[model samples]
Target: MKDMFCFQCEQTAKGTGCEVKGVCGKTAPTAGLQDKLVGATIGLARAVQKTKATEATDVCIKKALFTTVTNVNFDNESLTKMIACVEKKKAELDPSAENYDMAKLWEDNEDIRSLKTLILLGIKGVAAYAHHAEVLGFRDPVVDAFFYKALVAIGSADAGMNDLLPLVLETGTVNLACMGLLDKANTETYGTPVPTEVPLTIEKGPFIIITGHDLRDLHLLLEQTKGKGINIYTHGEMLPAHAYPGLKKYPQLKGNFGTAWQNQQKEFADVPAPILYTTNCIMPVKDSYADRVFTTDVVQYPSMVHIGDEKDFTPVIEKALALGGYKEDKEMTGINGGKKLLTGFGHGTVLGVADKVIEAVKAGDIKHFFLVAGCDGAKPGRNYYTEFVEKTPKDTIVLTLACGKFRFNDLDLGTIGGLPRLMDMGQCNDAYSAIQVAVALADAFKCGVNELPLSMVLSWYEQKAVCILLTLLSLGIKNILLGPSLPAFISPNVLNVLVENYNIGPISTPEADMAKLLS
Candidate 1:
């Protein structure tokens, strides 16, 4: 990178390149290390193509991509170590293996760079789902194989729009498979999620705050701390844990502690309990709570106690006990002042009652459906999501996923044909569920998905959201409204291609966007 050009996420500075540092709190050194890691990962993928992808290769690419995701790995030391590992693996596989310098991708013609960015970032999102599923012993060799192909395409010479465009859409196809694999792993392992309300109150006593989207880590922590007097409060994407029967059955899996991930700096500054980070969206840990920050898997911070592959959380448990949390029950409210929020309206739950939802639409009880889902950020225009949901017509049903739902999740938009107006569709990974429901609705209505009364008004923040957007576009889902702002990586021409082919564009005022989308 000339000066560390990164515009992978929604919060890119002024919707342009972040030449100095990332708005998400990443340093130049960290970005360079991530670039090197991606380069090494591409080399490894090339070598794997020559040989064959193993379970280990799948694991390596998954970790490499996950590590490069924004806010996941800020510690340059860890990223450098990851690069070394990828290089070593490449050498073992192909003695002639050479790392692809990221400068080539960064300095490429603008349109090529944009398309390649779409593939790389989209795979990063897929790798996240793959890694999570692998943790639970669900591996799709077909999905795993696509990573190598996509990486090779990204690194290949003479590759341009004609070569890379199909791979770009394939990334979405593979990501859908990855998400389906994860959905199976999650549902089979944790039981399909049900509608459940979680309190925002922090129970009195020693506790552990588990952030990120990994339920396996949360389950392990609950197991280790079962009788240890430490209550486990879900934070960030982990908030949906309360709806899973297996997770909620754990008596110690208490209520949620904080709101979305972006508020962690202030919300966790003086948190009395130890905080365990199992995935990304971690802000630079404030010194006030640094000692209590424990990271695992791909999430790493320098000097934080890292719980490695063994998944032994005893260190975190001991810290929680040592810190001895709040003196009394601390009641917290969401931004809306509502005491509780509901989640677990995934495909299973929604499709289980699809008949009623369809009947309601036919009877005009539900006129339109909006899938307002994506990552939440702390930028100026983020409130567009909340306002969009609030202003949706009374007869419209709003389905949400990811941390962005925190904006207005507590509003209790009432019910339509016995279904809540707003249905929380688990985490961003659960975009798989939204896709399933969309395809099903299109089938039922005997029309294309775009022809259905459903619209996707998405708010994106990171690479995962980037991949999800690509997946939607790849599926030919059109006329989608994207906001906060359009991605910075998309040059004017590339965006024109998308606008002409897909009709995707940034959101305007909530009222205007709603009117346009509903029209």
Candidate 2:
């Protein structure tokens, strides 16, 4: 049999669909198994769409789709379990229900594949947020309802381009709500994040490196290891945890340990600390620290101990103690050689200073607002984001989120009206905070967001960025620049459709893009 096709991320083979293997190190067998899992999940959704969805239905569907997201789960054994669970759900909901074969969509007309891929990839991103929110005891009915709707639309053979196109944008509408729910969950559980400076040095003794974006897992780990002499350090998207009021109270919660998700292969190799992954951006495990990887929720890799619902960290804690991290204090720094970084300047923080921001704008002290944010990647061109920020004028405020900020996050961009020129707005999920701040600013200025001197220059690396891009488009935001590169799955016709509708284009040089935006 021939290999399966996949192009859901920015790293797809040759900047297009992957045939033999995924660009992110996923093998042909792994890709096929993931496709099978997605097919089974769609079958379960088809079954649940007929019957009223129960809580179990919603949870299972979200987890199933989230698992298929890029770089999330690579273990065929765990995927096999998800497939069986979905089949069982289909049987329970309606024994006669049948799974929609995903190959049909992949092999369909080019235009259909483009539009459906948008909806499919968009929902995969949405499922990640919904799963995060669900674990925090927060759930939105509309957000939950849209998952089934999107899955049904993608699986629908009869749906025309006209149908899938709107559904593609609607995925953004639903994802906005999902992000909102997750923001609420994080705030309510962890308290609002305050502006905080996190150190880059690792103290001597036992420590655990926590990566990905799930705060609940971080919270659980913090609680389980309270007095165990194990230090917890944030890595990747979890870096913002140091700014949350509830989490930062833990004395043993130390500083960050890595630059970005893309550099984990080098950053994590030969590390003394055990790493616990709560969500995505998990690269293939390296032999250097393979024995120390502990995963909970949907993040899975073969042979690594899966932290089940028990959520116990005793095993990870024991590993950290045994390894006895850093014979001496290891001083690390950001890419820019800064010893500290700032985060948690979320919407609540931004809005609290809205009057100062508004006054600065009125006084012409702040000329433009640039949201230079998105997923960071290994691509060479991504240096554009770093240079773009370095080149952004002093009178502008740069807001960033996700792993993309690692490029220039350590550079001291100076302050404007008592606010840092570059503000860290939590994780990718906290794009909700950035949106909130934008809407609030627009309201304060009594102008539409586009008219408020704001521009978004985003870097794309994964499906989460795709959903966030759709959200911005659905809101009628225009002239946005997206790079390191566009998604490989989008056909030229679909690209024309997006460009014609939204005026979004690929990134140019930092100087050229800035000249255009600040002109």
lDDT of 1 by residue, 260-364 (tens): 999999999888889999998788888999989999999988778888899999889888988898999898999889898899899999999999988998888
The TM-score values for the models, in the order shown, are 0.98, 0.99
Question: Which residues of candidate 2, in runs, are more than 4 Å off?
Answer: none
Kindly list the per-residue Cα lDDT of model 2 for residues 401-451, writing each as its tens digit. Answer: 999999999999999988899999989988899899999988988899888
Q: Which stretches of candidate 1 lie over 4 Å from their true place?
A: none
